[model samples]
Target: MASTGERDGTGGTDGAETAAGTAAAPAERKASWRLVGPGIVVAATGVGAGDLVATLVAGSRFGYTLLWAAVVGCLVKIALAEATGRWHLATGRTIFDGWRSLGAWTTAYFAVYVTVWGFVYGAAAMSSSALPLVALFPGALGLKTWAILCGLAGLAFVWFNRYAVVEKIMMVFVGVMFVVVLYVAVRVTPHLGDAVTGLLPVLPDGSLLYTLGLVGGVGGTITMAAYGYWVNAKGWTDSGWMRMMRLDNRVAYLTTGVFVVAMLIVGAELLHAAGTAIGSGDQGLLDLGRILEERFGAVTAKLFLIGFLAASFSSLVGVWHGVSLLFADFVERTRAARAQGTGGEPPVLEVARGQRERSWPFRGYLLWLTFPPMGLLWLDQPFGLVIAYGVLGAFFMPFLAGTLLWLLNSGRTPRQWRNGPLSNVMLAAAGLLFVVLCVQQVRELPW
Candidate 1:
């Protein structure tokens, strides 16, 4: 995939020595269509079992009325991911670096946020992945045992592998899960007419707050911020790759849209029609599995469980690699800022260019994500920490959206690459939407 730089005859050495948080542009080559990646990584990482459950619940309560919301959610994420990749390629900086450049406040919040969020999330991810395994094996191992094993496997896989290996595995897992969900959606024999109408914007009675979560709250988690890091890891560090990045970003969310739509269809046809209720989280998928077994037989149920495993494990490994990469970049940017503060030179070594996977920060965060959260699996998550995590996690999307708006519009970005009118509108809308969700979530949290 030749970048725009290569095509335009201005390739700027492929992000060789770009600094962490500087306003620099690494010359790029024009993007080739066939070499798209990173999107899969973001997509796989974004659509965890929790997300699927949310979509399923939306379907169960309202049928296809909120299908439009699912599609809009995909569009919102597409804009966010595109802006993220654009910031990285247009200005040769990592997302963490961009956030740092805005001020110390961004970094401080992120430090606390990632630390708390990762500890809680690691436990959640492991347990989510472990759910299917326990169901399929029928008591071969306890939930905590399976959860620990899942966490360790993800840690090991990401610890030794590079971005290329990670992307390929993500593609395979996402691909399999998509097919599985699509098959189930088909098997359920959805109300085709209702689904078509669902494409139109319409909200059912009393589905406001609950539906609003799906309506505007679709941009997954920190993985969206990690999109840029993954882009650099793909070796597309200049504006030349902008076209490919946009296309790749679109493909990512479209795949996500299809996945969730299929789940909604299953919930609408299989569960909603009979007024069936399922658990609201990972156990939700297990409930669906039980229903599938009772209705369709063991084979179908097992297949769905396998799909659940794939979806969960892909997220586990993706976070292990992607977020660790982000944290590594964070450490690099922080150290560089400190050096500059002390009248020393901050390092010019950019992420993804110097084998960042081998870096200490990356490995440290990986272990931090893997081993530290195991305790939460054995015991109840502390109420105070959970509340803190809830608040931080809720506010992160808005923080990211607001900062992207600031960084992309300011002098930090080149004149030619600055946010256009459409970009501004979309980003502003995203920021406001996230703020509303944040307020709602905080209000609901058990403070």
Candidate 2:
């Protein structure tokens, strides 16, 4: 049952519950910080099939010439996520709380981002998830029909479950994704010499945009901002959890790095070697599936399809669960700040922490992610929304990178937990890179 909370006339939860319930909840975890779960959830969420497809296209075109960029992408994400998680652990406040402290501009950017980004992303995620299903059980259902089913399935899972169940299930899917991708990568017999030489920092001609995309796109998602919430969900709210959080963030990106490299290998050795071309987006994975069947056998093709399904669906549900929690926290934080009238300072509203998963805003956002987007699954996405999504999506990483630098460096964070020199350098570079990518995305849009 949803816990009854103090609500004003407008029906938003008034403040983050400052009661003992929120604090004690973290203590109930028996071996809480010892196990690695949130990182797996993040890895599963961030590295969706679309991301892998982009990596595959890179390999098919450049044949590992951009391999160094992929490695750097992983490192960059580690720094960003570490800074995010650090803010939560070091300050005992949610990221939204920190954002509230930064002034109203942060709020305006996030509000626009989650609203437009969530709707278009829901449809795309469901379509991507359904693609592998349609391939696996070809005549079982039509594409739109499968897409709706996928969306509903994700909705039901996230709606009924809490963080732990979500984490465990995501971990299983991550395992499936890892094994199948690795098998395909190894089966292709990648040239060791080329793989080694590809690690050098040389870019082939005409590959600048692709190189930028590779660096900015790997394992990066809106989910990175949600890492702190996931950490708090695991009952790791204080600086004591900082060590484990850093390790967790590293493991998350390491897993992602492996996924990126393995997919690139499949593209380099299989598609590139054969001089084969595949359609782009999730469809590219389908093209690869057909090739696997023709060359290897039915079993190999089916296994690849299964991995594809796992990758897509894991991302679908991970976003469903994680982002809703983010939205809930977003709502809760905004309401609390207004009630406190913090005069644009960090609201001292961190006392009673309610379970964001059980909050109305969280469930409402889950529904927002699920049902409304199904209309797009049937009809094509409205061209304007698509354009808006692309534009806003382009802006998000830069927004996140820029904000983390701001929040983690200023008085908003405790002095001890502030970003170090290396973190600053990595984040600034990430910010600059994303800004470049954002401009490219806008230029390519059909304005």
Candidate 3:
């Protein structure tokens, strides 16, 4: 039986009950803030070292002119994340289960993508997380040694912890990251007038590509597809949680917007004002740290380095936990399909009771993300693997958007939960935007 509070006018509950429940809307919205874990985890996980570097680079080149693009990026991601969460709560099914319903091809694509993407990403994420630590303690160990230690630490942490524990840890890291980044933003003193003006759309000369990148890349990744799993992990497993999930989704992007805006301010005031260029990749953050030390002092620089580590390590553990949960679901569904011999269509498996955190498939992917990637720390990343990673990454957002457009508007979803006109427009825009961005990324890749 659906609760009166959850059934809106459009939902197919008793009309009298929905009319009577309208008065409680205010209280439910007010209480939604307390149920905000999955969004924070998703936002924190999405804004890793790469996002910081990209925003910094944008600030370095264009100052506040591209601020609107970052804001747009957050809005776009909010739509994606909201759609993902809505699916889980509305349908009472995992994302993998939805993908399986699409076809075996979806499963095949994910199988290849996750395996390759994780292998390469594991090494990159470990390396990114290691940079700040290596910078902070130069006398302690080599970068590779630090990277291995970081990977193993994340593995052990996620291996032993459940979703509640993981969410709490991620929140602590997000808090540290928020404060440090906000301090840097204030310390540099952004130009209020120009930043406000940036809210209006204006693409500066020679900034078209960077503007598009900022718009498309502020806070997005494969981790977004894992969002529904995180929501499930948090035990929000029914349509009754739909409104709460949407509120949580809004908070997630709002938090992400704040983080990116702060970074843009730091970039505009610190890097642009000084006319300094930082190197690309995670090392770019290190370059910025050195610049901060020169401009301020060692203590300030160390604080920034600590924040960088927080950002990187949060992403590290997030994937270790969130993606591991996704892989665990995939494994469980695959086994269930085999056991029932249900060709490609498996029964919908409820996520509320799975021991996902301790499952072997979960541990196996965690090990895959930890151990094998360490080898890439010593050896050059194979050219083929790098290309594959780039290609797969390019298509992911559009894939997500296109699929959501199909799933959310169809009979697969309940009529009340179907995509409205506004959602349809947003999903369409996201799909087209990402498709264009995907072409640019592929064209720019050194093939």
Highest lDDT scorer:
1
Clashing pairs in 3: none
lDDT of 2 by residue, 316-404 (tens): 99899888988987887678756866354333443333367878999999899988888887787788988999999999899889988
Ranked by TM-score from best down, the candidates are 1, 3, 2
lDDT of candidate 3 over 1-447, digit per residue (tens): 121111111112212222223322222233367778989998899999999999989988889888999888888888899998887666555677667656688788888889998999999999999999999998899888899999999999998878888899999999999899998888887889989987888988999888878877866888898898888777666666778888888898888898989988888889898888899988999998999999889988999999999999999999988888888878878777777673543343433344777789999999999999888988998989888988888988888898888777765566667789988998899899999999998887889
Off by over 4 Å in 3: 1-30, 342-354
TM-score of each: 0.92, 0.91, 0.92
Judged by whole-model lDDT over C-alpha atoms, candidate 1 comes out at 0.83
Cα RMSD (Å) between model 1 and the true structure?
Answer: 4.8
Q: In lDDT terms, how accurate is model 3?
A: 0.82
**lDDT per prediction?**
0.83, 0.82, 0.82
- Tell me how far the alpha carbon of residue 272 in candidate 2 is from the true structure, in angstroms, after superposition: 1.0
Worst lDDT 10-window in candidate 2 = 1-10
**Clashes per candidate, residues 3 or more apart or on different chains:** 9, 5, 0
